[model samples]
Target chain A: MEFSTIIQILDSAVRLSTPLLLACLAGLYSERSGIFDIGLEGKMLAGAFAAGAMSAYAGMPVTEGGLGMTWGMAWMGVLAAVAVSIVLAMIHGFASITLRGNQLISGVAINFFAAGSTVLIGQHWFRSGGQTPPLSGAQRFGPINLPFADAVKDVPFLGPIYEGLISGHNILVYIAIATVPLTSWLLFRTRFGLRLRAVGENPGAVDTAGISVVRQRYAAVLIAGILCGLAGAYLSLGTSAAGFVKDMSAGKGFIALAALIFAKWRPRAALGACLLFGLLEAIGNRYQSIDLGAFVVPVQFMQALPYILTVVILAGFIGKAIPPAAGGEPYVKER
Target chain B: MNKGLPKWADVVLIPLLSLLLAFLVSGLVVMFIGKDPIQAVQVMVSGALGKFGIGYTLYYTTNFIFTGLAVAIAFHARMFNIGGEGQAGIGGVGVAAVLLSVAWPHWTIAIVAASLGAMAFGAAWAAIPAYLQAKRGSHIVITTIMFNWIGSALIVYLLVGPMQAPGMVPETVGFSAGAAIPTLHDIFPAFDKHAPANVSLFLALIAAFAVWVLVWKTRLGYEIRAFGHSEKAAVYAGISPLKIIMVVMLISGGLAGMMAVNTVQGEAERLILDTVQGAGFVGIAVALMGRSHPVGVVLAAFLFGILYQGGGELSFEMGIPREMIVVIQALVIMFVGSLENMVRIPVERLFVRFDKGAA
Candidate 1:
């Protein structure tokens, strides 16, 4: 492949992986704190719908049942997405924590709830066949050019790479990229991180250390909600399509979970795993099929690659993937 | 948990109360969307149970029964098999291959052969995840979910490439007329002729009974329940975890695959892209609400069947999306499966008070 072609692919990979990166980090927090979250997909879907609907409403005129605001109101959309996702995360926490119900069951229920409610309510409110109105102009997150992108464009080999691959994404993409290091620091270099990791691996020890297990778990779940909300917001507002379509998240949340497993639940590794999955997706989107000398590789196979790789990783064909010891089990304080 | 409640109440009443709670929450959702909740229920009932609609209701019920039993069997082995969607999809491929291979002399022989093909293919698809869980220590939930995506992709590849008919559509050609199963209308003569309810409904009932026999009356059934209750104790008793996991998953996968017979050979009569729809996930709700009991599965499956048929009608008449049924299904799972203690504890307390008063 030419350097320019490679750069283009990397650009697409970065764009596509933003959501996966956000959701993967979200899972990292939740899973690291001993709560197995299967509902990340559901929460992301709900957040996408909330952000899409809210942004569309904000952009429209007051006469048409909107807030009559401009680009500034897009922030409100992000806030709405976060709030809605947090509510759902709290519901999952309530079911698995307070009620001590099966975490998997709660996750399954949340997924269905989000899948159904988003469409049902969207159809009721917007009447657009379960889609938010298409967004444009300031209503969506337009790409931002880095300071020297224009100046560096004339420089041969390094110019295109810097401009095309590294710079010029919506703010959410930059936030998603920045979040990787921030998450690594929060998870490994902080006092709270120790307690969080301890709680996931050995809640009994955390309890003995005079920490409140329930509070820590709920906090982790909340952070997961916030990160997932950013992922959803990016899906709806940051993408070029710039509006919510039905099922637009389209199993990305699960892919993020797969990336989490592939990464062995580490922050930096999650970025690499997500980007690799994203690169596969970008290649699939760019080409219908690749002609090899002997056989053709179909787009369907490319689309299915991440899932296949995740299964391979999980089966220990690559490496052993072990979850936190206390993950997925509700903690009951022994009297 | 049910120390104060009678056996009958534990088996029957708690579920009913939970169902009521689910419906109540669903009603609130309907009302929140500015629809009349009572009118929604009324419409759902008439549309699902009315003469013409009952046929469709039963058709959906047939699919649910098969998938629900699949989940229930795995639940008995203490495994959560969420790949019913993929298993059923591949089962359709199996049905199509069988029905399209050659001309059959009769529908009876064809249906039997196709059913076997469906079961085999479904079991084959599930075997990897089962083996991984049993031997490699992989999480079955994650692997099965990945398998669901992979299965769908494989189906898409098949439909678009080798299986594609001469036309532009990405579907297989219709099966031979001899391969088609008898619809409910052909047998009853009074049923709706347009509806898809077919001889496979009887198969579903038979499968339910067979599952009950397999889970309760047989030695294998005892071992499964024992393993489900306590894996350590079951292993101590000489029951191998590997044997139970593999056998249970194969059976579960086979049961889920049987659903394709109803949809493929009986109704659609061809392999299409979304053959399983979301019926696989609906099975999870049914199994949870059914408490993994055969009798309870039948009842819960019927309830979901009504919701599905009625929800379709609701979308047509009231402009409510058909997804309303999915929302209700979620609520039922939440109440019956996840939040069971919320209702059970209060009910247990009430029963304890009543017992004290009697004493």
Candidate 2:
């Protein structure tokens, strides 16, 4: 492959991987804390719809339910997405913790609720055929080229890779990148992280130590919601896309969950896995029909690669994935 | 968990209360959206239970029963098989391949052959995940979900490439009329003449009976129950976990795959992508609410059938978003499946007090 061509592919990889990375990290937190969130897709969808609808509304005239397009309005959209996701997270926490509900069932319910409510409200408010109107100007996230990117375009290998592959993205991409290290430190090096890991592996032990297992698990789930909220926002608003489409989160949340397991719930590994999955997606999009000596490969096969890969990996073709020992079981206090 | 409660209360009262809670909350949601809740409920009820609506409700119920039974069987083995969607999709391909390959003179023979094809294909789709979980310890839930997406994509590719009728649309040609299953209208002249409700509804009932017998009366069922209750104890008792997992998932996948017989041969009479839709996921809720029993599965499936048809009517009549129906369904599942304890504990306490007073 040509150097510039490779750089372009990497650029798309970075852009596409942003959502997966965010969601993957989100799943990591929830799963590591012993609450598997199958509803990541739902939460992300809710976030996308909220951010997209709110920002679009904010950009419109006040008479039309908008706050007049401003940077703050977009930020408000982000905040709304996070808030909505947190509410959903709380619902999951309440059911699986306080009520001792089935975690998987609660997660599935959250997904269904989010998917349904977002479209219902979106249709009622926008009347735009199950989508939010496209945002413009300050309401949508625009790309940002690095300070000296343009000047280095004429330089050789290093310059082309840096400029083409790493220079420009919407601001959310930078935030997602920064989160990798921040999440790593928070998960592996902090007091909270130690307690959270302990809670997942042995909530009974954590309980005996006087830390509330319920609170720790809830905190982890809420943190997941925050990251997933950003993921949903970046998908509809921060990316080159300008509007929210119903069911647009597609299966990315599930794929993110797969990536989390693939990384064995490690934050740093999740980043790598997301980027690799993103690269595969970019390749699939770029080369729909590949001819190697014989008949061409079909487009659907490429599109299905990530899911197929996840299943294959989980089927133990790679390495065995071991979940937290105490995962999926409700903690009960003894009398 | 069963302390101070009768079997009937555990079976009936809890589900009823959960259902009531779901409707009340759904009503509030409708009011919040500025729609008249009473009118919405009235429209939904009339639409679902009245003349033409009853036909579609039964039609959807037929599909739900198969998938619900599929989930129920897996639940008995303590396995989470969420790939019913994918299994049914593959099963559609099986039904189509069989119907198109043969020009059976009668619908009776064709239906039987299509069912066998569906079961085989569905079981094939589920086997890999079952084996992985049984042997390699991979989580069946994640693997099955991933397979759903893969199955959909595979079907899309097949329909667009090799299976496409000479048209540009990504669907196969319709099945020959001779192979079309007889509808309810044919069997009962008094029934709605054009309702898609077919003999498959009868088959669903039969399948439920079969499941009840298998889970209750059969030795294999005893093994499955024992394994589900405690794998370590089951192993000690000579009930191999591997055997139970594989056998149960095969049965589950086959049941789920059988849904395609209704959609492919009985209704649309063609192989189309997305024929399964979200029925597979709905099966999970149905199984949960039904407490993983056949009779409960049928009852729960019928209720969802009503919700789907009625919800459709509400959206059409009141301009409520169609998505609200799904929200309502989700709420029902949440209350009945996840938050059952909220109502159960209170009910158990009440029942205990009444018993004491009577004594």
Candidate 3:
């Protein structure tokens, strides 16, 4: 393939990788703090719907210098999306923590509710079974063309690699990249990070050290909700910002969860894992455009790739990766 | 907190509260759409219980009972089995393979072969996760979930490949008359007009009783419950976790497979793309709402069946979306989390009172 083509592919990869990265990081926080969060998909769906509705109403472009009003509405949408997703997360926490219920069941319920409610509400508002109205460019994520990268656009392979491949994606892609080192620092190099890790690995030990296990897990899971919200917004606003489609999250949230587990809950490793899966997704998308006759891989098979990989990895093909000791155990205050 | 109600009051209270809470949430959604909430609820009730509705609802409820009991059996063994959907799907394939491959003179023989095929396939399907958990110490929750996706892919593959019946739209060939469940016409003349409520309900009820007996009256059941109660203590007491895990998963997968047979042989008579639907995941809610008991799952499944049957009717009549039933079902599971509390508080109180009275 030509350098430009490769660059284009890489650019698409980065764009595709962001939502998964954000959601994976979000899950990293929650699962690392001993909270199982299968509801990341639900939270992301809620955020995507919220962001789409907000962008639709906010980007009306009134002639009376309405920048303030527009920005305010957009911010309100973001806040609302985050707030709703967090409340759902707290419900999950309350069930698992307060009621000592099964974590997986609670997460499944959250996901089921989110999927159904978001679609039902979206259809009601948008008058479409699945999709929302397309946002204007002003209402959407715009790309940034870096000065240095632009200057070197004509420099053969290097130009394509640095400028065309990685330079011009939307703001959210950059945020996803920034999250990696930031999450790493938060998980490994900070006090709160230590406690979070402690809670996952051994909540009783953390509780004995005077930290509240339930509180820490709640914080971790809420962080997961916020990040998943960003992921959802990116789907409807940045990556595929065309509209809010029912079930449009399309197992991506589950894929993100898989990436987190495959990475063994480390942020940087999660990025690498997500990119690998993203490559598979990108390949599948590309393959659909090709006419390969009967030899063509089915879309359903391609969709199942990440999940198949997850099982293979979980089945000990990978080296012994372990979860925190208290990953699914509810912390009960027994004093 | 104790206001001196009967010891069993809390057990009954949680489901009642959840029903009330779910209605409130659903009521807001109804009002949001400018519909009459009370009228909508009334329609739901009548649609589920009306003469035209009860038979179909009961038919669907049989599958729910099988799947719910499938899930509950595993829950008793402390294994989180989420592969019911996939297992059921695979089991449908097994039924198709059996029915299409044979020419049977006796209905009983065909049904028995189909059931055996389904049980074998389902057990083997679940064995993957069980093997992973047993050999590699992998978590069953994570592996079983991945297996669901694998199972889905496998079904899709079969539908498009060897199992695909020629000249049909994404569906397998219909089973032979012998392979199909016999209608209850001769046995119950009064129920001759009932559409699809066939002999499968008897099978389902028998399965439920079998589950109850195996879980409560057997030594193996005692071991399974013991392991669920405390893995460390069970292991210390010489129970093999690996053996129990495999056994539990096999039984769970087999039950799910039987549920598929009921759907394909008793209802559809062919495997379609929408086969099994989300009944497996719904089974988790049923198991939870039923508190992992056979009788509880029966009641819970019936409730779900009513909701599904009513929601289907409401969607056709009032133009209200059938997806609303999903919202209600999810809320039920979310609230069902408090079942442990509902169970614990009353049991503890009863025991304390009994001790005090003796003293």
Per DockQ, the best of the predicted structures is 2
lDDT of 3 by residue, B228-255 (tens): 8999999999999998999999999988
lDDT of 2 by residue, A1-335 (tens): 88778888889999989999999988888888988788898899999999998888788887766676556667877887898888888888888888888888888888899889988888888898778988777777788899889999888888887788888788899999899899889988999999999989999989999999999999999999998899999877886668789888888998888888888888888888889889988998889878876788898988888888877767666687788888888889877
- Model 3: clashing residue pairs? A236-A241
Task: Answer with 1 or 2, whichever has the higher DockQ.
Answer: 2
Arrange candidates, best DockQ first: 2, 1, 3
lDDT of 1 by residue, B12-91 (tens): 88888988999999999999999999999999999999889999999999999999999999999999999999999998
TM-score of chain A of 1: 0.97
Question: Distance (Å) between predicted and true CA of A57, model 1?
Answer: 0.7
DockQ of 1: 0.77
Interface RMSD of each: 1.1, 1.1, 2.4
Query: Which candidate leads the pack in lDDT?
Result: 1
Q: Which stretches of candidate 2 lie over 4 Å from their true place?
A: none
Question: Model 1: how far is B333 from its true place, Å?
Answer: 1.4
After the best TM-score superposition of candidate 1, give how far the Cα of residue A193 lies from its true spot, in angstroms: 1.7
Query: How far in Å is the alpha carbon of B245 misplaced in model 2?
Result: 1.5
Q: Give residue B152's lDDT in candidate 2 (0 to 100).
A: 95
